[model samples]
Target: MVQSASIQLENPQEWDLSDLYQSFDDPRLMQDLEALQQTAANFRDNYRGKVKDLSAEQVLDCLQQLEAISQQAGFLYAFPALIFAADTRNAEAKQMQDKVMEAVTGIENQLLFFDLELKSLDDQKFAELESASVLQPYQHYLYNIAKFRPYKLSEEVEQTRNQDSLTGRQAFINLRSLHLGEQEYDPVTTPDGKTCSTEAELSALLFHPDRDVRYEAYQSVRKVMQQHNSLYAYILNTVAQDHKLENQMRGYESTLQKQLLADEVSEPVFRAIMDGTKSRFDLWQRYYTLKGKALGQKIRTCDVYAPWGNDPVPPLSYQQGVDTLLAALSQFDVNYARRAEEFFLKNWVDAKVRPGKRGGAFCWYAHGKHSYLLLSYTEDYNSLFTLAHEMGHGLHFAWIGDRQSYFNSNPPMVLAEIASTFNELLLLDYLLKQAEDNPQLKQALITRQLEDQLNLLFRQSTVSRLELAIHDRVTQGSFDQSFVNEQWQSLYQDLCGEAVEVLPEHQVDWARIGHIYFKPFYCYQYTASNIVSLACYQKYREVGKDFIPGYMELLAAGGSLDQVKALRQYVDVDLENPATIAAALKYVEGLLDQLQATL
Candidate 1:
């Protein structure tokens, strides 16, 4: 697959990692490792048992050293990860990724006493550090780690888990990638006589103007999934078991507790999202009903993405995609456009879907360094928006680099999404404005944009619901594919209600989702992010450019502030408020109304 993508004038499509390491075997990669190991050993020698007696000044010195070590370790590990993401088939990339993760874990194991003993500090000393002006930056970091104090294990046990990780959760994830990467969906000829084989190829056909093309590609993918569902089911079960076992050992109250803690979100926030999103199934049901009428037939799963009224939009080229994205960005903030220019000029993006590259798009950020975007671009509206979404992540990382140190540069997964989705919304608004003279074009564009938001919010929430339910059941015992399919279809019934029908073959979708298999309880952040971003966008409508500085402040704050507290102080959106979710749903409805007028 990996298309011919040159972005624009003299733009490169492959990343230049010389900035990180010259190549996979660069001598500096190992040198960085040796230095990191020495730093860890020396730090342990200096502070292993001395944590209890350290003054506030000494604590500041210890924090600085820890940050330096963590920063360098992050850079070393990020190198191979970025490489493997661009080309999963690269043997050397895979070796280096695994090697770095294993080595970094060893370094971290030596430094475990820093956090453990810090948390064990007497109440007075902990409070003194919390109030010290010099220690203000580390206050939130210190407070967050304190939450894990209850879950902390003996140093030996913690080290064992670190070493075991390569062969445990991460090992299963890698194996699943290897198994799924080479899968071949049968080739289906399009209505225009072009042939295709890859999943990305088949998926593109699913949105073709011709129904025959869409269904042929759809049925072909279903046949392929049927062949692999059992293996996927087994992989999921094994990983879920490991997850449950670890949570139990750590004394976590629930499967989702740690994830919520990591994001600094409360159970109430999650509950509000679930309640708010599920309550609006009627919105999706109505949209599907309208879509079915637009197609002049029943709305099956395959027909959902199909274009209506036979007005096939012209395809965009890679160069055209770049131009459209930057133009839209410039409309909101030329500064963003300026930052985005580097993605093309510096080869910061790997956009073509070559053989065995990871299946989806992500912006991998290296702390204190730059970010690289791995995307599968096909020169369509969806692909264009994907470029914007990931570039949002790239932009966020770049904007935060100079403002926050390495440890604080990464925002929570929830706030991490604000930049990406907000970028998508800006492009959507720009496209909507351009099509205003032609109602037909306007309707189509609005429907497309709303559908993307709906997918991000509603469908992503359903994904998390399925994970929660599956994990609950797995804790009871292992389940077969039939059981897994039933759980998936039941959730479909919940989301679609009595109106929409999910194909039996599509029931195995639970197998194909990569997030749950790799990072359990992760998908809900998409739902949460969309809700929060839309709320932030609502603010933008009130004050325009006046909102940009405050928004920029949140991104720069990163993990330096509490996730919800940052939202409250900077953007004035309270995540725990159910009304926030309702506001996002109302936004969806307004778009649906616009689409209805065209119908």
Candidate 2:
């Protein structure tokens, strides 16, 4: 629900979860849960502790069954999850979500022995199973499991971790979401006498032409975050320690080793991207200096997002935002537009922010052919980009799941952001075209485009660096709120260097960052995917239509192809080599040069 505005903002809306079930109380829900449990029991009864004894055909059959059971469970859980996200205050939905999670835990427990048994096979025996021609389709999925063989805990410990997480790390994440959803922000008066209050509204001021407005919004946001300082810091440390303890128990070499293994990305590739971005910190510094000089002030962290010129991009309604995103995606492929259209036309998108609703957005897909997208979509330039971003994810899920089986439907996390970020790049190009004749507007667009690159490439790298530091530090000793604040501010200074002044208020941003509390070591994916998308965008710039077919093929590829293998096939990117990152760095520098020249 947006407040008063000059334009007619689209009303916030909810999605119809009926496609999954008529209601939460639908008997089908219970039937599916019971059946999932029964199916898991049967699977365990058939395959438990028997991987070494089973023939190749038996292993394949067992995997197929496991896939089917998991899909059914996913379908069941998606509804309550959607309902809870759509309105976290709904008592019935919360109860249903809790019950479903409890049931799913039982299912995880029943199926716990399957993967452990699979990982237990000797190398020669495992090679024989993997070499079976009939098992080719499951090769990617099976091969991924083998990577975790060294880290595999006993079946009992694995199940314990699964069950314990509902109360441990996950509960902290849930609390943080609730804390963010219910928090209030006081209205700040803008230079133009406008009053802003909502999280979305205050956020827009951070990029306002008036420095006072941006400073006030910064102070207001930091004030709200500091109000919950102790709680957020505790949640962050708890989550970090949870990961650290789990890593030690599971025999993981590093805290991030599990995510690397899970994402199917190599260590060298992740480091290459991090090192590449850090090595090119001057580009970030240069952009900040140029933008700050244009505004006639030293750039502060609050001013880091400032546009090159004061001309504001007009407000784009939610419907207009969808149209704009689809039009940009249509330039890529008709199928991309078609899939994106489903989220809007099919009533599959929930684009609203309200008390008790989730604070951010995510596009969710189950075994079904469709998707549901959630966003706190305020009608602004940034909100429009958010729409494009989430819808990109919707298109990816719709395309990939349509072609791949349940076990093979999800791409590596590092590559997951590619389609989403690519859509944003498309939108940026489209926006630039609209501003060709207006100098101020064009400068604003270029500023936004370049700032977005910095945010994704450089800012995410800093967050990743901080996350790694936190995880490594938590292993040794205890930390308090001040300890975290100090580390966060230090990283901020390191990223901004002498170009952007690191504001004292912005250090509390570390406390408010939900991703660090929720998904350990996940922010790096944004950087990794942005680099890959930049490379693909470069190819599209050169070959035009010749790039679309292969690009579309990459989206259609799920876990059926490993990330490095898929990138090589689609874009010939050698992700392991420093050159891939070097290329993206060069692109960023070129964009900076273009912006400086054009503006």
Candidate 3:
């Protein structure tokens, strides 16, 4: 008889597209598109001049109907964009995405007057409509719209701005994505003699045990980025300047002012986090000093991710990894375990490392039906943590999809990572306990956890500061390539101190972070999320099994509440307090002590 070892676990259930549509060619898609167009046209025809004249109930019903239609259109357009990004070479998928974007753009253009019209209503009428039960669920969003009433432009100007946005500054950013964002790397031979060059491959090299390999990978990456620096710098400068112009027009006090307002967070809270992290820069320096001694090098930025010692890569079978995650999750609650198992069993994840698939992992939930996970799994220890992290995001999406409408499906980025990072913290704690008897594994786990904190806290904080400096300079009409490079060096020096040498070639690092180009002032969320997760992790340790249900409920709340409200409700931490961030740094300090003991 054949050995049972010869059998392998089959891949999990692939995404069920029926809920989206039976297929791309399914008639429902076309019907939905046509219905969306008709709805927009009908809404404009019926409500353009009649909203103020209608009763509160009628106004609320009209807004709900419009939102429902818009939500359907959003799913129709976004699902294809995600599908295309995962497999860009698919001609049909690409065409479908393009068609949907065009149709949605047209629909949006037709409905551009809705917000302005609503804002034009008298205060008493607006209050009555807002208080209507039908619209009460969307009060937060509506109130946010009303908050902008003070700055509302004339209908003609607003329409012009909306139209120009598509072809003006926005088009430049879109062009950058199509042109400058495509980076190709030269292949480097690994120790095993296999050559690899993709971004994912080079990223993995950063974790390689061989110092020479890690250094070479870093050099290659810097070289590639340097080659594109001129173009990248132009894109960066233009995007920042564009933001400056828009913010000035919108009467924002500063570039970051609007972002703070949207997050329902104050600038001082942001300043406190930044100032608090900077004051503890020595923590990062200490980490790098320990890392350099372990790697036996006078550390450089290139050696930052080099492995500490000669240890063979531990191989993890896919099933074993899944089992590990499930077991670790079981500590939380049965629901958490069941949800994770569903991801493995229901085909919700794309785990193969295929050619041209996007690098990095993400959980995409286009509709309430399911969430899709993208990963190039390598079966290493970090890969296991990555799977757990992305699955955490998936579980959050699954829970929120069941509880919220599509319009309210996504929480702010501030609250978004609470679930994902909480999952990572749980997994790390589980692993640490399991390895208590295995000294080498335990040391490695602690080291890895510390590295993650460095990335999420120190590195992200540095990036946030750089973003603020660049935007400030742009607002002052003085931002350029030299300014950005100087800011990068200054921030790096401040964070890393004398522990590592910042190479001249690393100056263009800002250009490589896609977030700067796509999202302004967004890296702060990583810092915020990490610290929030750290506090939540501690709470879990204190409360044990009692904490899981409340955590799940937080995920299920989605965008219904702002970050501050959701976090306070579940984790009982206040973003306004310095103690929250301080507590997380203390945890990192404790981990460092543990690692030093092992050394």
The per-model lDDT (C-alpha) reads 0.82, 0.81, 0.77
TM-score of 1: 0.95
* Predicted candidate 3, C-alpha RMSD: 3.4
**lDDT score for candidate 2 against the true structure:** 0.81
- Per-residue error for 75 in candidate 2, Å, reads 2.1
Model number with the top lDDT: 1
* Per-residue lDDT of candidate 1, residues 1-599 (tens digit): 11224345333166677788888768998999999999899999988988989987898899888888988898898888877877677788889889889899999999998888887777787888788988888778878867787888877887888788889877888888876666777899975778887777777777788888888888887787789888888878888888788888889876788778887888888888888888888999898888888778877777778776577777767687787788888877787787887778788888875666677788988776788888877767778888999999999898888688766877889999999999998988888888789766666677788778878877889989988888889779987778788888888877776556677767977776889887777888999999999999989978999998899888888889998899999999988888888899999999889778866
Q: What's the residue-level lDDT of 583 in candidate 1? A: 90
Candidate 3 TM-score over all chains jointly: 0.92
In angstroms, the error of model 3 at 497 is: 0.9
Candidate 2: regions farther than 4 A off: 1-12, 189-195
Clashing pairs in 2: none
How do the residues 372-431 of candidate 3 rate in per-residue lDDT, one tens digit apiece? Answer: 787766656777888888998888888888888765677888778878888888788888
Q: Candidate 1 vs candidate 2: which has greater TM-score?
A: 1
Q: In model 3, where do residues sit more than 4 Å from their true spots? A: 1-28, 88-95, 180-182
Tell me how candidate 3 scores on lDDT.
0.77
Model 3 weakest 10-residue run by lDDT: 1-10
The alpha-carbon deviation from the true structure for residue 269 of candidate 2, after best TM-score superposition, in angstroms, is 2.4
Whose TM-score is greatest here?
1
User: Residue 128 CA error for candidate 3 (Å)?
Assistant: 3.2
